[model samples]
Target: MKAVVYEGPNVLTYKDVADVSPKANEVKLKVRACGICGSDVHGYLGITGRRIPPVIMGHEFSGEIVELGEGVNNLKPGDRVAAYPLDFCGSCEMCAKGDVHLCLNKRAFGVLDVDGAFAEYICVPAKVCFKLKDSVSYKVGSIMEPLAVSYRAVSHAGNLTGKNVLVVGTGTIGLLALSCVKAQNPRRIFVSDLSDSRLEIAKKMGADTVINPSKENSLDVIMDNTNNKGVDAVIEAVGVSATVKQSIDSLAFGGTAVWIGISDKHIDLEMQKIVTRELNVKGTFLYGFEEFRTVVEMLNEGKLNIDPILSKEITLEELPETMAQMAAGAGDIIKVTVVNND
Candidate 1:
């Protein structure tokens, strides 16, 4: 097997590794396409606590089943499928409630205590494989995970129809959230980011307005667009400390702000605004497979057009250079996918 291995901080290499064998109730997939997620960049830069070196580095993936272990009966070889990526203990209280992401024993591929798909083949639990139509290319199936996160964020935040929503970042997740909320047909949407390129992408993704705080002013643009009233909802897609505060400021008197990004550390919040404005700020974790499957349907039905966000595709060997570009914020990179094995 040829895969991309994390060497150390800001380092990656393509190397030939031993093929993986499926455990009981698992299946082996021949990797066809995999998307580069922000967490992969975090782990590449050694900023995230969960990612350790000497491991494969991709999670948002789709492939064809090459083999199935004992006890696997629902699927067979040659099935086109997407990797659910989440590993949860079905016995936990959260799991019993159908919230596997919150289970105490949750494990995610390419992030925590597991290997991942960024190679010729990957082994995953048979339970995590969801079949995709032959018409849905592996490239498009790879997007199910990111859109699933957006779906979870909006679902947990109640309604968005006819509400003015402010998305406080224009990354892939932010852009996806913009599109997801647009399905509800919000009154207006304002997207903020430091990069004009990303802000442009957000606009095409259904944001009514774009904000580049570095070039102009986020508060001014958002306030002006909302008829001097703050937005009805603020979704924080940037995990940095400053953006968290900005997300708070974007809220209206009785708006909700959902934090969708994973931050590095604790950042202070304005209790006064939270109390006086009655603003709701909530944290949404990953999605259940059901929501994930919903996102896949949306993609296949053409309700969600993610084609504009895929900036480039690279081979596994190009991951070292291309991933560095993504980490440094260079190049007009959206979601970089590995299209071929090393």
Candidate 2:
């Protein structure tokens, strides 16, 4: 089997590696498609520290089951599915509360210790697999992870009906967040990004106003469009100091800001603004199991249109070069899904 192994900062080697097999209560999958997430780019650049390499790094993936371990009765071989990448201990207190992502024994694929779906085959717990509908392509199934993230973020933003909402950044997650926001029937949607190309896609994805901060002041554009009042809510998806501050400043009094991006670890914010204006700053991590299931069903039911954010499709052989381009921010790429053509 061949996998793209992360050697060190900005180094990825495509080489043959030992094959993997399913453990008891797991399933071995013939990986069909995997998407390059923003976190994967950060790990490649050694920025996030979550993806301590010399490991296979990819979490958003879809595949067909080739073999099922003992005791796996919910599914069988030949089922096309997308997996919830977090391996959590179902007995933990957090898991008992249904917050599986916060379980102390949780292990995420492609992060730290676990090898992931960047190869031709990978094994995952049978419990994490969600069967895809016949209408969902492997490419679309691979994107369910990010779609779940966006859905969780927007879901925590409370009701957006008839309220002005702004989304900071227009990357894959940002653009998807915009789609989730649109579904809530917001009065208007504003999107800001440094790249004009991404903002153009955001416009096509139903953004009422798109602001390229590189060309002009985003706060100024946001204010002008919102009648000098800040937006009613903001979904911050960049996770940088600058964009984090922008998300806070572009909010109206008592507005909520649901942050889902993780590009930056530390951000200095104005404590006074949060205090005086009574703003709500919420930090949403990965989705709960129920939320993940909801997005999968939404995709299956054709409730969300994620076509505009999917930039291109590549083979596993192209990951080394494609990942470098994403890390350097060189291409006009948005969301890239690596498909296995084996």
Candidate 3:
């Protein structure tokens, strides 16, 4: 099997590797499409410690089950599926409550402890795999993970019907968050980003207003649009001090702010203001099992528009160079997917 192996910081090697065999109660899948996430770029740059070297780094993927391990039930070979990357201990308290993402013993594919789908084939727990409808393309199936993350963040924001919402950053997650917020029939959606290309894409994707903070003031634009009152909800997709601050400052009184981005930097927060304004600030990591299943259903029903968010598609051989380019911020690309054409 050929895979894009992460050797070290800013290093990726495309070479043949040992084929993976499914364990008991697992399935071996021939990968069809795997999307490159922002976290992957960060891992390549050694910014995030999530992607350790000597591992295949991809979790947002879709593939066909070529083989099933002994004891695997309800699914068989030739099934088209997308998998939830997190594997948790079923006996844990969090898992018992169906909050698997919070399980104390959790191993995330392409991240913490598991090898992932950056190759021709990979094995995953049969329980994590969900069958995809014929109407959902493999390209779209690869995006279910991030879409699930966006859905979870929006769900944290509670009811958005006829409320103003602000999404910070126009990256793939932010764009997907925008789409999820729109589905709730929000009165207006404001998107902020430094990239004009991404902002344009957000506009095309139904953002009520797009603000390039580099040129214009995003806070002013948001305030003016909402008649001087801040937005009712904010989704912070950029995990930076500035963006985190912006998310907190852009919320209305008693409004909700959900932080989905991951960053090590700490920001100074006005605890007094938070208390006075009665703001609801929450941090969301990954999606739970229910959110993951809901995202797959939404994709199958064609309720989410993911076409504009896909920027490029490349082969496995092109993955190393593409990761380097993404780490260097070379292009205005939003999302890149690696397809196995073999």
RMSD of 3: 2.0
CA lDDT, every model vs. true structure:
0.84, 0.90, 0.89
User: Please, what is the TM-score per model?
Assistant: 0.89, 0.91, 0.92
Residue 100 lDDT in model 3? 90
Residue-wise C-alpha lDDT for candidate 2, range 284-317, written one tens digit per residue: 8777888888988888888777888878999888
lDDT per residue for candidate 3 within 63-177, as digits (tens), equals 9999999999889888999989888889999989989988999888899446888999999999999999989888889998999989999999999999999999887889999
Clash pairs for candidate 1: none
**Poorest 10 consecutive residues by lDDT, candidate 3:** 261-270
Best by TM-score: 3
The digit string of per-residue lDDT tens for model 1 on 267-296 reads 877789899989888998777878987887
Runs in model 3 with CA error above 4 Å? Answer: none
